[model samples]
Target: MSPPKSAQRLENKWDASRAKNMSEPEKLLYRSNLLGSDKRITNYGGGNTSAKVLQKDPLTGETVEVLWVKGSGGDVGSIAMDGFSTLYMDKLNALRGLYRGVEYEDEMVAYLPHCTFNLNPRAASIDTPLHAYVPARHVDHMHPDAIIAIAAARDSKALTQQIFGDTIGWLPWKKPGYELGLWLSDFCARNPDARGVVLESHGLFTWADDARDCYDLTLDIIQTAMDWFAEQTAGKDAFGGARHQSLPADQRRAAASRLMPAIRGMVSGQQHMVGHFTDSDAVLEFVNANEMERLAALGTSCPDHFLRTKIRPLVVDFDPAKPDIDATLAGLADAISDYREDYMAYYERCKHDDSPALRDPNAVVYLVPGVGMITFAKDKATARISGEFYVNAINVMRGADAVSEYRGLPEQEAFDIEYWLLEEAKLQRMPAPKSMAGRVALVTGGAGGIGSATAERYLREGACVMLADIDETALAETAENLSARYSADVVRTVTMNVTDEAAVVSACSNIAAEFGGVDILVSNAGIASSAPVEETTLDLWNRNMAILSTGYFLVSREAFKLFRVQDMGGAIVFVASKNGLAASPNASAYCTAKASEIHLARCLALEGAPMGVRVNVVNPDAVLKGSKIWQGEWLDQRAGTYGTDKDGLEAMYRDRSLLKRSVLPDDIAEAAYFLASDLSAKSTGNIINVDAGNVQAFTR
Candidate 1:
């Protein structure tokens, strides 16, 4: 059954004066009503709506007020005054200059300090700068499932150009932050009369002098796309010309409840509850269809929707007549695992440090053969909405395909938006390490000790790791051990001296050529010297710097170049010693080289920020096992200086830290994992002490 003609006309009305004449309170209600009119219209806090309210500035004796924007965490359909963040128009415009050339996420965070207005309960939208760029009094942004479905399809640009024509401007996907705002500003400046702007792989933005005009423009564009889609695929059926059968409501609800907790756990601590089925027959029928797999591969309508709907649809393979619900649940669990592994491989092929690793599926639409579609969400309303969005997207995509072909935005472009700064910043503020799946990492000096441990940790977190060291035997052995435990192709080992510039460059180039790109780099290779200042030879100092300081510089520079050229922001980890921070007696050359490496990382952090790169240092205190530095004259002299037996000296070093435990390679690797993942997206130019608490020892 189609929507009535009156309903369609009501949906299309562009009543600018109705909003212009309404009071602020009336306008808020109208906005909410408009937001709720379509379910696939918006998801969670995926959309933004705003109104400019003018008021008198008593202190300044002029007319200036707030531009009320949708606050973070507030759904547009249910937002109130508290959900809107009010920013001074003049101050927002003034902040534009601060955004230029700002590259690092932290630097952008620092710009918040320059704001003159009270930030209040709601933080300013990440799109605040874009909103400010618009001269319009009102603006609206939404990830309308229909619009995104059309945009995400293969050949989306052509489809969009065909449908949107000269009315909308398209901006390529970028890591959204100040750069995105600047891009939009430039576009708006050039096209003063554009109806709206669409950020590829992101969403849509529309603005006008009146709130109603802005909202209606959004509706008109979406409706046009919808109508165009319906016409194109009028005869094509999504169900693959298959018949559906009905399933019982009680059985569907039970299955949904069983699936909720597993999916919720995948998203960390997000609350998710099962919603009741409204179309039990449609769901049962779809699930029973033979072509369910083909239907599920259409991909999401928008990249961001993965946060709520996951990357692909969940195909429930179960017989409703079968009484073994537990067996069916087990089958679902296996399917999820298979899905996660497939996702991990996809991530490995295309993901960079800044990308979002796969999480669990959020909503599942079960298509029972004879029944309709049963969508499961945290609540009834959301479930119903998700179902409608999925169905509409599927229908349109199928139709668009029939017309010509549907091609999505480029894979790399989608990755940029998926790992965008706006979203990565939110993940960074969380407590635990974010997903590290699909990242390729290289650890220098990854033989027996600290390096091996670091490689193991990265492998555990789903990274394709390369272990490089001067010791060929140790490197091969460690690689084999890790591979045997984790399976083949999990770890790759290459023998090379970090001090050789050609060797470092070749190693980096080979990895990038082999794996497509390198996302994480750990510069852990180094040599140590223990002579006093006067006794230290120039030759010894030079050699120490070559391996410890210069080697790090060469490798990091290569990594930086690869990251920039590939357009995937990468992460570099320098494994410096605690001696870099605190002075140790009778080790001048070793201390100096370590200290130099630390400073090198800080400098790179600043330089790399513009290109979306992050650089950090890990200072581990006296790791004993697998360290070549622990052998030969260096170890004996250091032990003698401490006035203790070799074992006693090692114990003293371990006791120096606050944890009072020996530092291990695993500890440093865990720290490296955090730095490489989304956990450290906002962290750069920072020193992480993996030395337990050695710094506290000097203070005491």
Candidate 2:
């Protein structure tokens, strides 16, 4: 069996002249993209590829053959030349002779630095030696789900022989290291015609003179394994039991939002961690399958998954149809504690004196009886990665269970890989991650100047943001621009009128359901009204208060309720105005409403203190460039008050402040971001004035 011709995306497109023109690194990178783009082959950060290149050392001007392997933490799907770590092949190959019976910790990891060809060496993948020993032009290693299905089966050796006969060589469970690579090289030496080898309970490897041949060989072998698996399970239940369906989408979402917070509260230690909810039809079906508890507890599909998700996932039993969600959530804390205690016992059972200190005991949690899975981690990327790997595990395990019993590596082997020094070094190689990596921040009126800028700043700090505004077009455009700039799906848009209590409640629920819970709220939406007290009509006053005062109350009230539910402290910043502190003639309505919103923040701050929630205010004046409030009649009225045209009013407003500078939205956003971040952790119920020293608005 082979992949359909159309499935071959790595077909040779290069003629002799084109191949001559392309650099070796470019050719290798092109093949990496072709192989890594398909999830059937690899998941995020799970696979490595390498090319043996002959290049002249820039410093020495000597041509050397170096093994350019994928660097640790580099995704093969978008790998660049810099993503590879160049190591001298002779030095890397020399280690194979000295690797006899030595602890990988003391020799392999410590000696890797001596093998590098470059002065500033990037950390290479742990499997670099595996490629170096092959002496092939190109090598590809991927944890394709199809191969894992067969490799992790109960009788994996027999299945390996049955599937590919003599073409595939099989190695029993061994933690990846210099020894494993040596054994693989010796096995291939014995079988000179072997297409590849199946590292039992791990992954697959294929090699050829051409990169395309190597990639295609991987695909062909995997397709053959998949066809063999399909034939073995013909007319049988793929899931191995009766399938169940989940609750309706709306009910399922409601249940996730209501229950995820309790899990977050119990699992998050001193630091706050966010949960991400994800489920597909396949995931739901797997969750609903009979005996899922036993199947999911069997361990990960492969060892690399252990680095992201632990060896086993924590499964919680619950019924989404039950109306008593609060009762369900109450019992979850005890269950989570039980899971932690069990994890510690496992750690103690497998401890070596040299093992790294125990990692955070919490593992990704899986829910059943209606809702799907919830992944918990220090940040959003890790959480999503954990969830994704587990989802892949479900499919692979099902495929294995369909033919024979599914089996992962024994607990001891898994422990060895999890605490391996080479694996642990990968984390050390990564740069320090962002501070707000996993948080959720929502900005009201996010289409406006200050709100949009604040959202952008949060995104830069690694927080996923939700932009809420009544203007759907502007909100969508802002989200698009931010997404393009960041090259991430970190921002979402919601059309919301903050004054409507129902809309506010629904929006908050949606945000919680999407990203676990809200970590920060910027209550920045408002309208500006300018009129003399005698000319201020009932309609004008009502409209002004509705947006400025009532809107703030509604949004803040909902956020407060959610924060209490999550039992996690959050930050709230209200964007007030300088006019709130100092009275201005002919703008009684605007000034009064602004003052009301500021006091509203104070009142909420006092209430939220005991729970660790912080509330603050940012007062900015005369941000004319992007301020929607400064256009139309409001701008005309303010210019008239200063006895100047609109264009000259900026200077007049600047002259009124002590610093003699015009305020901008970015200035106010910086103040709000500071208050919402940990910088102002202890300071709440405080106002940050961004008006360039307005004496009238000065506070002692």
Candidate 3:
């Protein structure tokens, strides 16, 4: 449906207001709101925005500073000045020559010192180079829902040509990070006067000498596509006007639980998971309808979305009248398996790596026969966004079919773009400790010593952090203290148990709703228990696993969901101790749980790799300022074992590391920021040493 004329006028007025704004903050907020207004409008961290600011660098004299280009973790609507990583334009432009060969990530990290900032934060945007490459004073890149929908249709190229005319240039899909930057750099260099660039199976990029021009160009391009789609689909009977049926809330929840593990496994190794389920009558009935297969064959609107929605939706052939629930589930599994095998064959034909393929599909659209269509996501927010895109795609496809057949990217081409080398280059950039700005992070167990230090480091690096912990009093007090020092928004507090599934869900939902989606998730919530393996009771093991192992799973799960669905892919930092690698005496449960987390991070890294999500672990040794294991009896026990007094014992642990210093929470947090930012994009599943130099013992 076309947006009402009045709403269009309001948008126009807002655009005018934004154009008139000379203040940096106002322009930032304006562009953010514009990008956030639609679901299909932006992929999680898939797009970018920037504004040129006049600043005087100490040595560079007067130079334009890109005051803020949306950092890796920020959402357009909620991002602030702090969300943008400021860089001297001359330096950024000069670095163009520095980007060479396959080792971009390392090069970027090494160059972090060149960029001056009060806080040496980690992780810049993957497209930092692209933003730097653009000579425009302001730039906006987005994967607008309307554009993706149109682009996903059968004749995307023709449609694009019809709608955007010559103002936009279409580049076939390539992996996003470095290759994209390179491709864009070449394109911009070749066509200096081009208004924008559209990445096939990806999104759109717009730029101008001013912020307002770039913002309006994005809106105009998307609106044109939306209008073309509406015109093309005006009288399509392809939808069949089928409506979906709703299921009982309990059943829906149960179904979601059953699907969560598969979804988690699919996107494992990354942090953050956001899922949404729709059992509305229209969805269910349409899903279960006879023509469902025909409907499902319509490919994803864009290639990038494949990481989120997968290649196609799962159509469940549900028989609500079945007397045997187990049998029905078995049948569902069989059907899903068949679908998965078919997908694997497609992958095998194009497979480039020996890594096992994802077991869970990115999206599952179930057809409960008489019921409605239901979609599952890693997180609710993602599911909702996926649903929005699917609905729009369906509408456009149906409309196009009314006039003629719909077409999408050719299969081989789609695969090539999906596995493009350029895209791979983008994913491998290292974290820049000095360039991170305007990003937000949520560090669980923030009241703990490691968490507190990490939070402080993030604050120091110019990131807004939401510190969550089970210790409400401590969490609140810490947040208060941090707030007193930083901007009120820079530090917020949430008290919740990570073990409670509901709390995990609520926490993620609330964070996204409040801070736009978190850019970094530091899964540092854990418990330490030491007992002989033979003496460890089931209860003790279960409790340890619940908080230490399962808690990381829950938090990382939610974070991945959010990150996947948002425009910017986020970074996740899991805090596992050296014990995770090397066993400690009488610490079986603790070691086992930590080890599990490490493995989980590895899995997440693989899954998130294709989507710009980077996951890494920080193994800090003997930084026990806030750990339960650091207090009274535990301290005495550890000191006695080490044959020294408390302080001496601490030094013993510190000296075990190459650095010969206590690994502070700040150290871990700094590592976390690096992993979460552009600085560590290529370093997923990496085990970063925050433990000084304790690797020899751990390896031995």
Write down the TM-score of every candidate. 0.51, 0.94, 0.51
lDDT of each: 0.66, 0.81, 0.65
Better of 2 and 3 by lDDT: 2
lDDT of 1 by residue, 598-654 (tens): 999999999999877899888888887778778888788888878887878778887
Worst 10 residues of 1 by lDDT: 1-10
Candidate 1: which stretches are off by over 4 Å? 1-29, 100-119, 243-292, 319-330, 344-700
Q: How many clashing pairs does model 1 include?
A: 33
Top-down lDDT ranking: 2, 1, 3
Model 2: which ten-residue window has the lowest total lDDT? 1-10
* Residue ranges of candidate 2 with Cα displaced over 4 Å: 1-20, 57-63, 104-106, 118-120, 321-323, 487-489
Candidate with more favorable, higher TM-score: 1 or 3? 3
Task: Give a tens-digit lDDT track for model 3, residues 1-700.
Answer: 2222122321432556435745864675677667766544665545678777776555556554654577766777667666777766667666657777644543554464476343435346656777767677787878776665544455666767777777887777565565567688799888887888777656778888866666777777777766665566554433454433345655654544444333333333333343345555435545544455676776655554554456667765545554234455556546766776877777778766633343443344544444334455433445565666565445444444444455555666656555555444544553543344546689898888778888888788766678888988889888888888875645778888999989888777656533445678989887767677898899989988898888988998988876665535678889888888987887788889888888899998888878778888888778776675587766776676567998787778877777777766667777777777776767887887678787643543
Error of 1 at 560 (Å): 58
Positional deviation of residue 381's Cα in model 2 after best superposition, in angstroms: 1.7
| Candidate 3 local lDDT, residue 280 | 55
